[model samples]
Target: MVNDKLLQNLSRNLLKILDDDEYYDITIEVGNDPYVNIFRAHKVILYYRSPYLRRILSTNKKKDDKALIHHIKLPNILPEIFQIILSGTLL
Candidate 1:
């Protein structure tokens, strides 16, 4: 149906934003030590998509004054697992 196609297109577009480096307002660092991976994302998208992240963001609402970018570090999750988690959140 038309609606399904529209949704598919929307999802594709949303995924494109994940790789956009110019406009992202937040940096998420996943994992610890030598295995860490950093990802950039929009705060508004993260705010609405996941309740767990919402709670985390709520506590860390203050962005760095110089760059205006918020930073979050997750030492628990592996980078590979976090990528999968983030993709699910965007969908």
Candidate 2:
């Protein structure tokens, strides 16, 4: 059986690792125009969290190339909305 406290702690640790440029493997660029907000996260975490993201990230050639940073563009989403996504992850 999974321990609730243990699971929550693990999830918290993963969230703490978000936007950590040193260990991050994915770069999410939200919005467009003069103001674009960039977020750094882990592809593995994202893959396990969302199927649509899994499909989209899978199709991106840059990730397959094993570059230093994988890129994803979300031109339609606002930074505020994306912030909710980032904060809501694993919560």
Candidate 3:
């Protein structure tokens, strides 16, 4: 079960962090299941299942280098994760 208030707060904080950076373009949407929030920017996308869990996927291609997909575990750390991703420091 996802907490509505917690979702709202997470979204708000994420937006603030994104707004502070000019290099990041952010798009946030609620998934069809109503239990996930999808955040997309550039070649990166993060699916936030709840305050305690989140999945991050990113792609980066450089010439002959193959594109890569990265996954991170965010456990009860929404704010920190949001800030890190928004800051473009998560890889």
Candidate 4:
């Protein structure tokens, strides 16, 4: 029971990090043009939690001039679906 409570607290903290904007290192562009939604996410959390994102992030190199932020475009994924995925990931 204690372990479960600790995990729940950890999940809550991670979700807070997910909602944070200032420390984000990745910019995810979801959906097609004109209707795309941008999401700011932390690379460390994504890299450690999801293998699919890990592969996508591995190939994406950070530019020297840019603010050291990694940008990824996902035209096939709907914004709502991506939001659901993000929400489900932490829980």
The most accurate candidate by lDDT is: 1
Candidate closer to the true structure by lDDT (higher is better), 3 or 4: 4
lDDT of 2 by residue, 1-86 (tens): 99999999998887687646788888899899887988888888777777777898777755347577778898898877777767
How would you encode candidate 4's per-residue C-alpha lDDT over 9-88 as one tens digit per residue?
98899889978999888899999978899988888887876777788887775455466787889899888877766666
lDDT of 2: 0.78
Flag clash pairs in model 1.
none
What TM-score against the true fold does each predicted structure earn?
Answer: 0.73, 0.73, 0.27, 0.73
**Better-scoring candidate (lDDT), 1 or 4:** 1
Off by over 4 Å in 3: 22-60, 63-91
Q: Which residue pairs clash within candidate 4?
A: none
Backbone clash numbers for all candidates listed: 0, 0, 1, 0
Q: Model 1 off-target regions past 4 Å?
A: 1-9, 62-67, 89-91
Once fitted onto the true fold, the runs of candidate 2 whose alpha carbons sit more than 4 angstroms away are: 1-5, 61-64, 89-91
Write down the worst ten-residue block by lDDT for model 4.
Answer: 82-91
For all candidates in order, the CA lDDT equals 0.82, 0.78, 0.44, 0.80
Candidate 2 clashing pairs? none
State the lDDT of candidate 1 residue by residue for 1-91, as single tens digits: 5698899999899889877899899999988999888988888877777887889988876555576787899899788877766676431
Candidate 3: what lDDT? Answer: 0.44
